[model samples]
Target: MRNLITFFILNLLCQSLTVNADELTVTLLGTGTPIPSIERFGSSTLIEHKGKYFLFDVGRGATIRLSQIGMYPSDIDNIFLTHLHSDHITGFDDFWITGGIWQRANTLNVYGPDGTKSFVEHTQGAFSLDAFYREKQSSLNLKGLEVNVTEIKEGLIYDEDGLKVSAFRVDHGAVEHAYGYRIDSDRHSVLISGDTTYSENLIANSQELDLLIHEVSVIEPKLLQSNPKLKSISKYHTSLQQLHKLVEKVKPQKTVLNHLLLIGSDETELSHLLETKFQDKNIDVGHDLMTIHLR
Candidate 1:
Protein backbone atom coordinates (compact mmCIF):
# COMPACT_ATOMS: atom_id res chain seq x y z
CA MET A 1 0.00 0.00 0.00
CA ARG A 2 2.86 2.42 0.84
CA ASN A 3 4.68 1.66 -2.43
CA LEU A 4 1.51 2.21 -4.47
CA ILE A 5 0.93 5.60 -2.83
CA THR A 6 4.53 6.74 -3.56
CA PHE A 7 4.19 5.63 -7.20
CA PHE A 8 0.94 7.56 -7.61
CA ILE A 9 2.50 10.71 -6.14
CA LEU A 10 5.47 10.56 -8.55
CA ASN A 11 3.12 9.97 -11.47
CA LEU A 12 1.06 13.02 -10.54
CA LEU A 13 4.18 15.15 -10.29
CA CYS A 14 5.37 14.03 -13.72
CA GLN A 15 1.98 14.80 -15.27
CA SER A 16 1.99 18.29 -13.78
CA LEU A 17 5.44 18.97 -15.16
CA THR A 18 4.41 17.75 -18.59
CA VAL A 19 1.35 20.01 -18.66
CA ASN A 20 3.39 23.06 -17.67
CA ALA A 21 6.08 22.34 -20.26
CA ASP A 22 3.59 21.90 -23.08
CA GLU A 23 1.90 25.25 -22.53
CA LEU A 24 4.74 27.54 -23.68
CA THR A 25 5.46 27.92 -27.39
CA VAL A 26 7.67 30.43 -29.24
CA THR A 27 7.79 31.02 -32.99
CA LEU A 28 10.11 33.21 -35.00
CA LEU A 29 7.71 34.68 -37.53
CA GLY A 30 10.42 36.59 -39.48
CA THR A 31 14.20 36.47 -39.13
CA GLY A 32 15.88 38.72 -41.68
CA THR A 33 17.89 41.89 -41.94
CA PRO A 34 16.84 45.34 -43.21
CA ILE A 35 17.99 44.37 -46.67
CA PRO A 36 15.53 42.03 -48.35
CA SER A 37 16.48 38.38 -48.60
CA ILE A 38 14.54 35.71 -50.38
CA GLU A 39 15.26 33.11 -47.70
CA ARG A 40 14.52 35.27 -44.67
CA PHE A 41 11.87 37.79 -43.66
CA GLY A 42 12.23 40.78 -41.32
CA SER A 43 12.62 40.51 -37.55
CA SER A 44 9.48 39.51 -35.63
CA THR A 45 8.87 36.90 -32.97
CA LEU A 46 5.66 35.53 -31.46
CA ILE A 47 5.60 34.08 -27.97
CA GLU A 48 2.47 32.29 -26.76
CA HIS A 49 1.93 30.43 -23.55
CA LYS A 50 -1.11 29.61 -21.46
CA GLY A 51 -3.51 31.55 -23.69
CA LYS A 52 -1.31 34.66 -23.71
CA TYR A 53 0.38 35.94 -26.87
CA PHE A 54 3.16 38.54 -27.03
CA LEU A 55 4.74 40.00 -30.16
CA PHE A 56 8.30 41.23 -29.80
CA ASP A 57 8.61 43.30 -32.99
CA VAL A 58 6.50 44.04 -36.09
CA GLY A 59 9.05 44.15 -38.88
CA ARG A 60 7.99 44.28 -42.51
CA GLY A 61 5.52 41.60 -43.58
CA ALA A 62 5.02 40.59 -39.94
CA THR A 63 1.28 40.26 -40.39
CA ILE A 64 1.65 38.03 -43.42
CA ARG A 65 4.37 35.98 -41.74
CA LEU A 66 2.23 35.54 -38.63
CA SER A 67 -0.67 34.46 -40.82
CA GLN A 68 1.61 31.94 -42.51
CA ILE A 69 2.16 30.38 -39.11
CA GLY A 70 -1.61 30.24 -38.53
CA MET A 71 -1.66 33.20 -36.14
CA TYR A 72 -3.77 36.32 -36.62
CA PRO A 73 -3.11 39.83 -35.34
CA SER A 74 -6.17 39.33 -33.12
CA ASP A 75 -4.31 36.57 -31.26
CA ILE A 76 -1.67 38.98 -29.99
CA ASP A 77 -2.21 40.10 -26.40
CA ASN A 78 0.64 42.61 -26.25
CA ILE A 79 3.01 44.25 -28.75
CA PHE A 80 6.44 45.23 -27.46
CA LEU A 81 8.64 47.39 -29.65
CA THR A 82 12.36 47.36 -28.87
CA HIS A 83 13.16 50.48 -30.85
CA LEU A 84 11.75 52.81 -33.49
CA HIS A 85 13.88 51.47 -36.33
CA SER A 86 12.06 51.40 -39.65
CA ASP A 87 12.79 47.68 -40.03
CA HIS A 88 11.37 46.91 -36.60
CA ILE A 89 8.20 49.01 -36.85
CA THR A 90 7.24 49.48 -40.50
CA GLY A 91 4.43 46.96 -40.03
CA PHE A 92 2.77 48.85 -37.18
CA ASP A 93 0.24 50.31 -39.61
CA ASP A 94 -0.53 46.87 -40.97
CA PHE A 95 -1.08 45.39 -37.55
CA TRP A 96 -3.41 48.25 -36.65
CA ILE A 97 -5.35 47.97 -39.89
CA THR A 98 -5.76 44.20 -39.58
CA GLY A 99 -6.83 44.37 -35.94
CA GLY A 100 -9.48 46.97 -36.73
CA ILE A 101 -10.71 45.21 -39.85
CA TRP A 102 -11.05 41.97 -37.92
CA GLN A 103 -13.04 43.81 -35.26
CA ARG A 104 -10.82 42.58 -32.48
CA ALA A 105 -12.39 43.42 -29.14
CA ASN A 106 -9.07 43.70 -27.26
CA THR A 107 -7.11 46.93 -27.45
CA LEU A 108 -3.49 46.63 -28.67
CA ASN A 109 -1.05 47.58 -25.93
CA VAL A 110 2.20 48.90 -27.50
CA TYR A 111 5.22 49.38 -25.28
CA GLY A 112 8.54 50.84 -26.35
CA PRO A 113 11.24 53.39 -25.61
CA ASP A 114 10.56 57.09 -24.78
CA GLY A 115 9.43 58.23 -28.22
CA THR A 116 6.93 55.39 -28.68
CA LYS A 117 3.78 57.31 -27.71
CA SER A 118 4.31 60.11 -30.20
CA PHE A 119 5.42 57.66 -32.88
CA VAL A 120 2.23 55.66 -32.54
CA GLU A 121 0.12 58.83 -32.51
CA HIS A 122 1.80 59.96 -35.71
CA THR A 123 1.20 56.64 -37.39
CA GLN A 124 -2.44 56.73 -36.35
CA GLY A 125 -2.84 60.26 -37.69
CA ALA A 126 -1.21 59.24 -40.98
CA PHE A 127 -3.97 56.68 -41.41
CA SER A 128 -6.76 59.10 -40.58
CA LEU A 129 -7.81 59.70 -44.17
CA ASP A 130 -8.06 55.97 -44.82
CA ALA A 131 -9.88 55.37 -41.53
CA PHE A 132 -12.40 58.14 -42.35
CA TYR A 133 -12.96 56.84 -45.87
CA ARG A 134 -13.46 53.27 -44.67
CA GLU A 135 -15.93 54.35 -42.00
CA LYS A 136 -17.92 56.37 -44.52
CA GLN A 137 -17.92 53.68 -47.23
CA SER A 138 -18.26 50.54 -45.17
CA SER A 139 -20.15 50.17 -41.91
CA LEU A 140 -16.89 49.44 -40.06
CA ASN A 141 -16.32 51.60 -37.00
CA LEU A 142 -12.61 52.65 -37.06
CA LYS A 143 -12.77 54.98 -34.07
CA GLY A 144 -13.24 52.04 -31.71
CA LEU A 145 -9.80 50.59 -32.43
CA GLU A 146 -7.67 51.69 -29.52
CA VAL A 147 -3.86 51.77 -29.57
CA ASN A 148 -2.54 52.23 -26.03
CA VAL A 149 1.06 53.34 -26.23
CA THR A 150 3.33 53.40 -23.18
CA GLU A 151 6.81 54.90 -23.36
CA ILE A 152 9.07 53.01 -20.99
CA LYS A 153 12.40 54.04 -19.50
CA GLU A 154 13.43 51.01 -17.49
CA GLY A 155 12.23 48.53 -14.82
CA LEU A 156 8.98 46.57 -14.74
CA ILE A 157 6.55 47.32 -17.54
CA TYR A 158 4.08 44.49 -16.92
CA ASP A 159 3.47 41.91 -14.21
CA GLU A 160 0.35 39.76 -14.19
CA ASP A 161 -0.94 36.19 -14.37
CA GLY A 162 2.39 34.71 -13.27
CA LEU A 163 4.30 36.61 -15.98
CA LYS A 164 6.72 39.47 -15.42
CA VAL A 165 8.44 41.66 -18.07
CA SER A 166 11.34 43.99 -17.38
CA ALA A 167 12.89 46.39 -19.86
CA PHE A 168 16.39 47.87 -19.71
CA ARG A 169 18.24 50.36 -21.90
CA VAL A 170 20.87 48.96 -24.28
CA ASP A 171 23.69 50.47 -26.36
CA HIS A 172 22.84 50.70 -30.06
CA GLY A 173 24.76 53.53 -31.72
CA ALA A 174 22.91 56.85 -32.10
CA VAL A 175 19.55 55.19 -31.62
CA GLU A 176 19.17 57.40 -28.53
CA HIS A 177 17.57 54.76 -26.26
CA ALA A 178 16.99 51.11 -27.15
CA TYR A 179 15.67 48.42 -24.82
CA GLY A 180 16.31 44.78 -24.06
CA TYR A 181 13.47 42.81 -22.47
CA ARG A 182 13.54 40.07 -19.86
CA ILE A 183 10.39 37.99 -19.74
CA ASP A 184 9.83 35.68 -16.79
CA SER A 185 6.96 33.29 -16.43
CA ASP A 186 6.21 30.75 -13.74
CA ARG A 187 8.21 28.05 -15.48
CA HIS A 188 10.86 29.74 -17.64
CA SER A 189 12.48 33.04 -18.60
CA VAL A 190 13.77 34.49 -21.89
CA LEU A 191 15.75 37.61 -22.75
CA ILE A 192 15.40 39.48 -26.02
CA SER A 193 18.38 41.67 -26.96
CA GLY A 194 16.62 44.04 -29.30
CA ASP A 195 19.07 45.53 -31.83
CA THR A 196 21.90 46.19 -29.42
CA THR A 197 25.59 46.25 -30.16
CA TYR A 198 27.07 45.01 -26.87
CA SER A 199 26.17 46.14 -23.39
CA GLU A 200 26.97 45.16 -19.79
CA ASN A 201 23.33 45.84 -18.89
CA LEU A 202 22.12 43.27 -21.37
CA ILE A 203 24.71 40.75 -20.19
CA ALA A 204 23.74 41.19 -16.52
CA ASN A 205 19.98 41.18 -17.23
CA SER A 206 20.22 38.08 -19.41
CA GLN A 207 22.35 36.03 -17.04
CA GLU A 208 21.12 32.47 -16.70
CA LEU A 209 18.18 33.10 -18.99
CA ASP A 210 16.75 29.99 -20.64
CA LEU A 211 16.95 31.55 -24.08
CA LEU A 212 18.78 34.63 -25.42
CA ILE A 213 17.43 35.80 -28.73
CA HIS A 214 20.07 38.24 -29.99
CA GLU A 215 20.70 39.82 -33.35
CA VAL A 216 23.87 38.96 -35.32
CA SER A 217 25.30 40.98 -38.16
CA VAL A 218 28.52 39.92 -39.81
CA ILE A 219 30.91 42.85 -39.97
CA GLU A 220 34.20 41.13 -40.69
CA PRO A 221 36.86 43.37 -42.20
CA LYS A 222 36.54 41.68 -45.56
CA LEU A 223 32.76 42.04 -45.67
CA LEU A 224 32.95 45.66 -44.57
CA GLN A 225 35.46 46.42 -47.32
CA SER A 226 33.09 45.11 -49.96
CA ASN A 227 30.20 47.23 -48.67
CA PRO A 228 31.22 50.61 -47.22
CA LYS A 229 27.65 51.47 -46.28
CA LEU A 230 27.51 48.32 -44.17
CA LYS A 231 30.56 49.45 -42.18
CA SER A 232 28.67 52.53 -41.01
CA ILE A 233 25.57 50.52 -40.22
CA SER A 234 27.42 47.60 -38.58
CA LYS A 235 28.47 49.85 -35.72
CA TYR A 236 24.90 49.55 -34.41
CA HIS A 237 24.78 45.78 -34.82
CA THR A 238 26.54 42.89 -33.11
CA SER A 239 29.11 40.86 -34.98
CA LEU A 240 29.40 37.08 -34.68
CA GLN A 241 32.55 37.39 -32.56
CA GLN A 242 30.93 39.91 -30.23
CA LEU A 243 27.87 37.71 -29.87
CA HIS A 244 30.11 34.75 -28.98
CA LYS A 245 31.57 36.75 -26.08
CA LEU A 246 28.06 37.74 -24.91
CA VAL A 247 27.01 34.08 -24.85
CA GLU A 248 30.12 33.25 -22.91
CA LYS A 249 29.15 35.73 -20.22
CA VAL A 250 25.39 35.11 -20.03
CA LYS A 251 25.81 31.37 -20.56
CA PRO A 252 22.20 30.99 -21.63
CA GLN A 253 20.88 27.49 -22.25
CA LYS A 254 20.22 28.40 -25.89
CA THR A 255 21.21 31.28 -28.18
CA VAL A 256 18.93 31.93 -31.12
CA LEU A 257 20.32 34.35 -33.70
CA ASN A 258 17.92 36.69 -35.48
CA HIS A 259 18.29 39.71 -37.78
CA LEU A 260 21.21 38.06 -39.50
CA LEU A 261 23.05 39.88 -42.27
CA LEU A 262 26.14 38.78 -44.20
CA ILE A 263 26.61 35.63 -42.13
CA GLY A 264 29.98 34.98 -43.83
CA SER A 265 30.07 32.91 -47.00
CA ASP A 266 28.18 29.91 -45.68
CA GLU A 267 25.83 29.17 -42.77
CA THR A 268 28.11 26.39 -41.61
CA GLU A 269 31.04 28.78 -41.12
CA LEU A 270 28.99 31.08 -38.94
CA SER A 271 27.66 28.17 -36.91
CA HIS A 272 31.12 26.68 -36.60
CA LEU A 273 32.65 29.92 -35.42
CA LEU A 274 29.93 30.38 -32.80
CA GLU A 275 30.21 26.77 -31.64
CA THR A 276 33.98 26.93 -31.34
CA LYS A 277 33.72 30.11 -29.27
CA PHE A 278 30.82 29.04 -27.04
CA GLN A 279 31.42 25.32 -26.69
CA ASP A 280 28.88 24.72 -23.93
CA LYS A 281 25.87 26.42 -25.53
CA ASN A 282 23.58 25.49 -28.41
CA ILE A 283 23.29 28.11 -31.13
CA ASP A 284 20.41 28.31 -33.59
CA VAL A 285 19.99 30.56 -36.62
CA GLY A 286 16.40 31.65 -36.86
CA HIS A 287 14.18 31.31 -39.94
CA ASP A 288 10.67 32.49 -40.66
CA LEU A 289 7.87 30.55 -38.94
CA MET A 290 10.34 28.43 -36.99
CA THR A 291 8.68 27.16 -33.82
CA ILE A 292 10.54 26.32 -30.64
CA HIS A 293 8.79 24.41 -27.89
CA LEU A 294 10.28 25.44 -24.56
CA ARG A 295 10.74 23.04 -21.70
Candidate 2:
Protein backbone atom coordinates (compact mmCIF):
# COMPACT_ATOMS: atom_id res chain seq x y z
CA MET A 1 0.00 0.00 0.00
CA ARG A 2 1.04 3.58 -0.57
CA ASN A 3 1.23 4.72 3.05
CA LEU A 4 2.19 8.36 2.55
CA ILE A 5 -1.25 9.64 3.57
CA THR A 6 -0.45 13.33 3.84
CA PHE A 7 -3.55 14.82 2.23
CA PHE A 8 -5.76 11.80 2.92
CA ILE A 9 -5.25 11.74 6.68
CA LEU A 10 -5.45 15.53 6.82
CA ASN A 11 -8.84 15.47 5.09
CA LEU A 12 -10.07 12.79 7.46
CA LEU A 13 -9.11 15.02 10.34
CA CYS A 14 -11.23 17.83 8.86
CA GLN A 15 -8.23 19.87 7.73
CA SER A 16 -5.87 19.89 4.77
CA LEU A 17 -2.47 21.16 3.64
CA THR A 18 -1.37 21.24 0.05
CA VAL A 19 1.74 19.56 -1.38
CA ASN A 20 4.20 22.20 -2.45
CA ALA A 21 7.35 20.94 -4.15
CA ASP A 22 9.40 24.01 -3.22
CA GLU A 23 8.84 23.51 0.54
CA LEU A 24 9.85 21.11 3.27
CA THR A 25 8.68 17.50 2.92
CA VAL A 26 8.39 15.24 5.95
CA THR A 27 7.85 11.49 5.64
CA LEU A 28 6.98 9.32 8.60
CA LEU A 29 9.16 6.45 7.47
CA GLY A 30 8.38 4.29 10.51
CA THR A 31 5.89 5.07 13.29
CA GLY A 32 5.98 2.07 15.62
CA THR A 33 7.50 2.08 19.09
CA PRO A 34 9.68 -0.64 20.63
CA ILE A 35 6.92 -3.18 20.19
CA PRO A 36 6.92 -5.00 16.88
CA SER A 37 3.91 -4.63 14.62
CA ILE A 38 3.10 -5.50 11.02
CA GLU A 39 1.11 -2.33 10.59
CA ARG A 40 3.70 0.10 11.95
CA PHE A 41 7.46 -0.13 11.40
CA GLY A 42 9.44 1.84 14.03
CA SER A 43 10.25 5.40 15.07
CA SER A 44 11.85 6.96 12.02
CA THR A 45 11.15 10.14 10.10
CA LEU A 46 12.64 11.53 6.88
CA ILE A 47 12.70 15.21 6.12
CA GLU A 48 13.83 16.87 2.90
CA HIS A 49 14.59 20.56 2.51
CA LYS A 50 16.49 22.31 -0.28
CA GLY A 51 17.37 18.97 -1.91
CA LYS A 52 18.91 17.48 1.22
CA TYR A 53 17.57 14.55 3.26
CA PHE A 54 17.75 14.05 7.04
CA LEU A 55 16.58 11.17 9.24
CA PHE A 56 15.47 11.20 12.87
CA ASP A 57 15.63 8.05 15.04
CA VAL A 58 16.27 5.05 12.81
CA GLY A 59 14.52 2.39 14.84
CA ARG A 60 13.82 -1.20 13.71
CA GLY A 61 12.55 -1.60 10.15
CA ALA A 62 13.52 1.91 9.14
CA THR A 63 15.39 0.87 6.02
CA ILE A 64 12.55 -1.32 4.74
CA ARG A 65 10.04 1.45 5.41
CA LEU A 66 12.16 3.92 3.48
CA SER A 67 12.12 1.62 0.47
CA GLN A 68 8.34 1.64 0.43
CA ILE A 69 8.40 5.38 -0.14
CA GLY A 70 10.64 5.51 -3.22
CA MET A 71 13.78 6.03 -1.12
CA TYR A 72 16.61 3.58 -0.67
CA PRO A 73 18.89 3.29 2.34
CA SER A 74 21.60 5.15 0.39
CA ASP A 75 19.48 8.28 0.43
CA ILE A 76 19.92 8.67 4.20
CA ASP A 77 23.18 10.56 4.55
CA ASN A 78 22.39 12.44 7.76
CA ILE A 79 20.79 10.95 10.91
CA PHE A 80 19.84 12.60 14.23
CA LEU A 81 19.15 10.33 17.15
CA THR A 82 17.00 11.24 20.14
CA HIS A 83 18.62 8.93 22.68
CA LEU A 84 20.68 5.74 22.77
CA HIS A 85 17.72 3.48 23.48
CA SER A 86 18.00 0.10 21.77
CA ASP A 87 14.72 0.47 19.94
CA HIS A 88 15.73 3.91 18.62
CA ILE A 89 19.05 2.77 17.16
CA THR A 90 18.61 -0.93 16.32
CA GLY A 91 18.19 -0.31 12.62
CA PHE A 92 21.34 1.77 12.32
CA ASP A 93 23.48 -1.23 11.44
CA ASP A 94 21.24 -2.13 8.55
CA PHE A 95 20.98 1.46 7.33
CA TRP A 96 24.71 2.04 7.56
CA ILE A 97 25.94 -1.26 6.19
CA THR A 98 23.31 -1.86 3.52
CA GLY A 99 23.40 1.73 2.43
CA GLY A 100 27.09 1.43 1.71
CA ILE A 101 26.41 -1.63 -0.42
CA TRP A 102 23.82 0.35 -2.38
CA GLN A 103 26.47 2.89 -3.26
CA ARG A 104 26.07 5.99 -1.11
CA ALA A 105 27.42 9.28 -2.37
CA ASN A 106 29.40 10.49 0.66
CA THR A 107 30.41 9.87 4.24
CA LEU A 108 27.73 9.10 6.83
CA ASN A 109 26.85 12.18 8.89
CA VAL A 110 25.39 11.24 12.29
CA TYR A 111 24.38 13.60 15.09
CA GLY A 112 23.09 12.38 18.43
CA PRO A 113 23.22 12.97 22.17
CA ASP A 114 26.36 12.71 24.39
CA GLY A 115 27.47 9.20 23.35
CA THR A 116 26.89 9.64 19.64
CA LYS A 117 30.52 9.53 18.59
CA SER A 118 31.15 6.42 20.65
CA PHE A 119 28.06 4.75 19.26
CA VAL A 120 29.17 5.36 15.69
CA GLU A 121 32.63 4.03 16.39
CA HIS A 122 31.25 0.92 18.05
CA THR A 123 28.90 0.24 15.18
CA GLN A 124 31.81 0.42 12.78
CA GLY A 125 33.95 -1.83 14.96
CA ALA A 126 31.21 -4.43 15.29
CA PHE A 127 30.80 -4.57 11.53
CA SER A 128 34.45 -4.23 10.54
CA LEU A 129 34.78 -7.67 8.97
CA ASP A 130 31.67 -7.20 6.83
CA ALA A 131 32.60 -3.66 5.82
CA PHE A 132 36.16 -4.81 5.02
CA TYR A 133 35.27 -7.26 2.26
CA ARG A 134 32.64 -4.88 0.86
CA GLU A 135 35.14 -2.04 0.80
CA LYS A 136 37.50 -4.21 -1.20
CA GLN A 137 34.96 -4.29 -4.03
CA SER A 138 36.24 -2.19 -6.92
CA SER A 139 32.74 -1.01 -7.90
CA LEU A 140 31.91 0.52 -4.50
CA ASN A 141 32.36 4.15 -3.52
CA LEU A 142 34.95 4.16 -0.73
CA LYS A 143 33.77 7.48 0.65
CA GLY A 144 30.37 5.93 1.37
CA LEU A 145 31.98 3.71 3.99
CA GLU A 146 33.39 6.65 5.96
CA VAL A 147 31.47 8.24 8.83
CA ASN A 148 31.26 11.68 10.50
CA VAL A 149 29.72 11.87 13.97
CA THR A 150 28.79 14.90 16.05
CA GLU A 151 27.92 14.60 19.73
CA ILE A 152 25.03 16.97 20.29
CA LYS A 153 23.70 18.70 23.38
CA GLU A 154 21.21 21.54 23.72
CA GLY A 155 20.90 24.46 21.28
CA LEU A 156 21.61 24.66 17.55
CA ILE A 157 23.52 21.73 16.01
CA TYR A 158 22.98 22.20 12.28
CA ASP A 159 22.57 25.54 10.49
CA GLU A 160 23.02 25.92 6.79
CA ASP A 161 21.27 27.28 3.72
CA GLY A 162 18.21 28.55 5.61
CA LEU A 163 17.75 25.25 7.51
CA LYS A 164 18.28 25.28 11.26
CA VAL A 165 18.10 22.19 13.52
CA SER A 166 17.88 22.74 17.26
CA ALA A 167 17.88 20.02 19.92
CA PHE A 168 16.04 20.38 23.24
CA ARG A 169 16.18 17.97 26.15
CA VAL A 170 13.05 16.06 27.17
CA ASP A 171 12.04 13.69 29.96
CA HIS A 172 12.00 9.95 29.18
CA GLY A 173 12.01 8.22 32.53
CA ALA A 174 15.56 7.10 33.41
CA VAL A 175 16.88 8.15 30.04
CA GLU A 176 18.67 11.29 31.21
CA HIS A 177 19.66 12.77 27.86
CA ALA A 178 16.53 12.30 25.72
CA TYR A 179 15.93 15.11 23.24
CA GLY A 180 13.18 16.60 21.10
CA TYR A 181 14.16 18.33 17.86
CA ARG A 182 12.92 21.56 16.32
CA ILE A 183 13.69 22.02 12.63
CA ASP A 184 13.16 25.32 10.89
CA SER A 185 13.50 25.86 7.16
CA ASP A 186 12.84 29.29 5.82
CA ARG A 187 9.41 30.41 7.14
CA HIS A 188 8.21 26.89 7.98
CA SER A 189 9.02 24.82 11.05
CA VAL A 190 8.29 21.40 12.60
CA LEU A 191 9.03 19.90 16.00
CA ILE A 192 9.65 16.17 16.55
CA SER A 193 8.98 15.02 20.11
CA GLY A 194 11.24 12.03 20.63
CA ASP A 195 10.13 9.80 23.55
CA THR A 196 8.94 12.04 26.43
CA THR A 197 6.59 12.40 29.41
CA TYR A 198 5.13 15.81 30.28
CA SER A 199 8.20 17.80 29.28
CA GLU A 200 7.99 21.50 29.99
CA ASN A 201 11.19 22.06 27.99
CA LEU A 202 9.54 20.42 25.00
CA ILE A 203 6.57 22.71 25.42
CA ALA A 204 8.85 25.73 25.64
CA ASN A 205 10.57 24.83 22.36
CA SER A 206 7.26 23.96 20.68
CA GLN A 207 5.90 27.48 20.74
CA GLU A 208 5.44 27.88 16.97
CA LEU A 209 5.47 25.07 14.39
CA ASP A 210 3.78 24.17 11.17
CA LEU A 211 3.71 20.52 12.28
CA LEU A 212 4.34 18.74 15.60
CA ILE A 213 5.06 15.00 15.43
CA HIS A 214 4.69 13.63 18.95
CA GLU A 215 4.94 10.20 20.57
CA VAL A 216 1.95 8.95 22.59
CA SER A 217 1.08 5.96 24.76
CA VAL A 218 -2.46 5.10 25.93
CA ILE A 219 -2.25 2.27 28.47
CA GLU A 220 -5.51 1.22 30.05
CA PRO A 221 -5.75 2.09 33.72
CA LYS A 222 -6.68 -1.49 34.57
CA LEU A 223 -3.68 -2.85 32.68
CA LEU A 224 -1.44 -0.58 34.70
CA GLN A 225 -2.97 -1.91 37.90
CA SER A 226 -2.54 -5.54 36.88
CA ASN A 227 1.03 -5.14 35.63
CA PRO A 228 3.45 -3.05 37.65
CA LYS A 229 6.04 -3.07 34.90
CA LEU A 230 3.51 -1.55 32.52
CA LYS A 231 2.90 1.19 35.02
CA SER A 232 6.60 1.95 35.19
CA ILE A 233 6.83 2.00 31.41
CA SER A 234 3.82 4.27 31.15
CA LYS A 235 5.79 6.95 32.93
CA TYR A 236 8.18 6.96 29.98
CA HIS A 237 5.72 8.48 27.53
CA THR A 238 2.87 11.00 27.35
CA SER A 239 -0.73 9.88 27.65
CA LEU A 240 -3.55 11.01 25.38
CA GLN A 241 -4.90 13.16 28.18
CA GLN A 242 -1.59 14.95 28.52
CA LEU A 243 -1.34 15.36 24.75
CA HIS A 244 -4.86 16.80 24.65
CA LYS A 245 -3.73 19.69 26.79
CA LEU A 246 -0.37 19.74 25.03
CA VAL A 247 -1.92 20.23 21.60
CA GLU A 248 -4.10 22.98 23.00
CA LYS A 249 -1.18 24.81 24.59
CA VAL A 250 1.43 24.29 21.89
CA LYS A 251 -1.18 24.72 19.13
CA PRO A 252 0.87 23.77 16.10
CA GLN A 253 -0.77 24.38 12.75
CA LYS A 254 -0.92 20.56 12.43
CA THR A 255 -0.10 17.68 14.80
CA VAL A 256 0.60 14.02 14.05
CA LEU A 257 0.76 11.35 16.74
CA ASN A 258 3.33 8.61 16.11
CA HIS A 259 5.05 5.86 18.17
CA LEU A 260 1.67 4.91 19.65
CA LEU A 261 1.44 2.61 22.67
CA LEU A 262 -2.25 1.78 22.85
CA ILE A 263 -2.41 -1.05 25.34
CA GLY A 264 -5.90 -2.49 25.92
CA SER A 265 -7.64 0.56 24.43
CA ASP A 266 -9.51 1.47 21.29
CA GLU A 267 -7.31 3.85 19.29
CA THR A 268 -9.99 4.72 16.72
CA GLU A 269 -12.52 5.94 19.26
CA LEU A 270 -9.94 7.85 21.26
CA SER A 271 -8.37 9.39 18.16
CA HIS A 272 -11.86 10.36 16.97
CA LEU A 273 -12.67 11.84 20.34
CA LEU A 274 -9.57 13.98 20.23
CA GLU A 275 -10.22 14.90 16.62
CA THR A 276 -13.79 15.96 17.31
CA LYS A 277 -12.78 17.94 20.38
CA PHE A 278 -9.96 19.67 18.55
CA GLN A 279 -11.19 19.86 14.98
CA ASP A 280 -9.64 23.27 14.49
CA LYS A 281 -6.32 21.97 15.77
CA ASN A 282 -5.79 19.77 12.71
CA ILE A 283 -4.56 16.72 14.55
CA ASP A 284 -4.30 13.12 13.28
CA VAL A 285 -2.64 9.79 14.07
CA GLY A 286 0.53 8.99 12.12
CA HIS A 287 1.03 5.70 10.29
CA ASP A 288 4.13 4.34 8.62
CA LEU A 289 5.27 6.22 5.51
CA MET A 290 2.81 9.11 5.97
CA THR A 291 4.33 12.22 4.43
CA ILE A 292 3.34 15.80 5.18
CA HIS A 293 4.34 18.64 2.91
CA LEU A 294 4.87 22.06 4.49
CA ARG A 295 5.20 25.29 2.62
Q: Which candidate is the best by TM-score?
A: 1
Give the TM-scores of the predictions, in the order they appear. 0.90, 0.89
lDDT of 2 by residue, 181-254 (tens): 99998679999999999888999999789999999888888998999999999888998878888988998999
Per-residue C-alpha lDDT of model 1 across residues 137-226, encoded as one tens digit per residue: 886676446788888879999987777889998989999879988988877888888998878889878866788889888756787889
Which segments of candidate 1 are over 4 A away from where they belong?
1-22, 225-228, 263-266
Q: Candidate 2: worst 10 consecutive residues by lDDT?
A: 13-22
lDDT of 2: 0.86
The Cα error of candidate 1 at residue 214, in Å, is 0.7
